[model samples]
Target: MRTSRTELLLGRTLLVVALVLTVLPLLSMLSAALQPADRNPTGLSWPSDPQWINFVTAFQVGHVWQLMGSSALIVLGVVPASLLFATLAGYALGGLRVRGGRAVLVFLVLGLTIPFEALIIPLYYQAQAMGTLNTQWAIVFPLIGLFMPFSVFWMRAHFVNVPVELSEAARVDGASIWQEFRRIQLPLATPALSALAILLFLWTWNQFLLPVVLVANPLDRTVAGALTFFQGQYYSSIPLLNAGALIIITPAIVVFLIFQRQFIKALLQGAVKG
Candidate 1:
């Protein structure tokens, strides 16, 4: 009983520490966002009068709505494409009896090792050849390609955790391979898929380098790129920048909160079964 009580106390202390560590930076950013613009030297302190208008100002001055629309278009295009391609590839690798499946998997795993920076110059040239530069397709296509390898890896791991006997049973019932995967395997992969969708959404939303390099027009820029607008050669607007940062970060936070359980489940799935 005494040992159990000590363990409980230790858990609570650790939770408190974790919460503080996670929240402190967010609190500082919020404070900075609210700080008066006319202050002598902007420091991280609670505002005497919180300027809730910073958010509004951020929207007006930054052309935030346009940036958001650009980001949304990229996310909408990339997430579904990545998920569908990854799911089909993962199902094939995990469940099918095709020859050279292991080789394909090894190639995909190798893809994860190659840095995106190395591919950017080549990708830019390809985009230019395709007449996609400064267009939404330029950013969207590369993000889809970059995200696919990891998505396949993640979904394949989850698919492997699903029991082989389930597929066998589906086959015994006269289901075709496609039908079995659609009806049995994909249904069982919901938790992992949900987790992957949220992750991909976050990643695509936060992508800066691709958009910066591929897109030149501010009208085509994403929220990640829009943050750079607040930084100038001679002057910087820290508070407004923090406001933009908050706007960019809030959606991801909301998504993680919504799918928190699914994310945890995906992490825990294979540990017990495999």
Candidate 2:
């Protein structure tokens, strides 16, 4: 089947429009960030004298290094723990026989439907009870649990498409269940795990509400949450604020750029599995 010329033209036009819509704001923000800090930069127009020092000012004023460290800590805690648990659960559910696995899966799928907003109150109080409030663990622990449903779903989607023959062949070679999972499946799961890691990192990095509500100290907040605080503190400094905002989101952008191929492959690999 071939697309008609009119359809092709229309599709190209739509894509161009989408690209502009996406890129225009980023360009506008970059322009704002480059403007002189003292001179309030208005709109997307390039400044007369581009002040690259706005980033330096924002970095210092925003305490961006500290924010980066805090966000990194959360990402390290959440991604590894969540991935380990989700991989194990996903493997058992998707690739192995478990008693009442269907019921368990249904429960996890139900968890996906429950919004975080609904759970925040209880989590806050629970953290307070545990004496972890105002600490990084407040964010770290909840995020891991909060991420479980989708992470498990993602891993299971990958694992379910894995052929049973691989497991059977491994079993015939005197491989135990743990041996098959560790030796055979995990090696084959690299792309999917990479994709999951990227997503987990992004989510854990960008988490705002949980940290804001649970942690009182600004130093303990994730970059995204700290950006909000920084916005309030520097509301008068438009260029600096924009610069800080850009800096806050840079890690996620870089991660996506580096792993984009593997990420796309993981998502699409199961689309037409043999």
Q: List the residue pairs that clash in candidate 1.
A: none
Candidate 1: what lDDT?
0.84
| Span of ten consecutive residues with least summed lDDT in model 1 | 35-44
Candidate 2 residue runs with Cα over 4 Å from true position: 1-14, 229-233
Sequence-dependent TM-score of model 2: 0.93
Q: Tens digits of per-residue lDDT for model 2 on 1-274?
A: 7999999999999999999998898899999999877668777799878889888888888778998899998888999999999999999888995889889889999999998899999999999999999999999999999999999888888888999999999999999999999999999899999999999999888888988899988888998865665565577878888898888888899999999999998978878766
Candidate 1 residue 231 Cα shift, in angstroms, is: 3.5
TM-score list, all predictions:
0.92, 0.93
Kindly give the number of clashing pairs for every candidate. Answer: 0, 0
TM-score of 1: 0.92
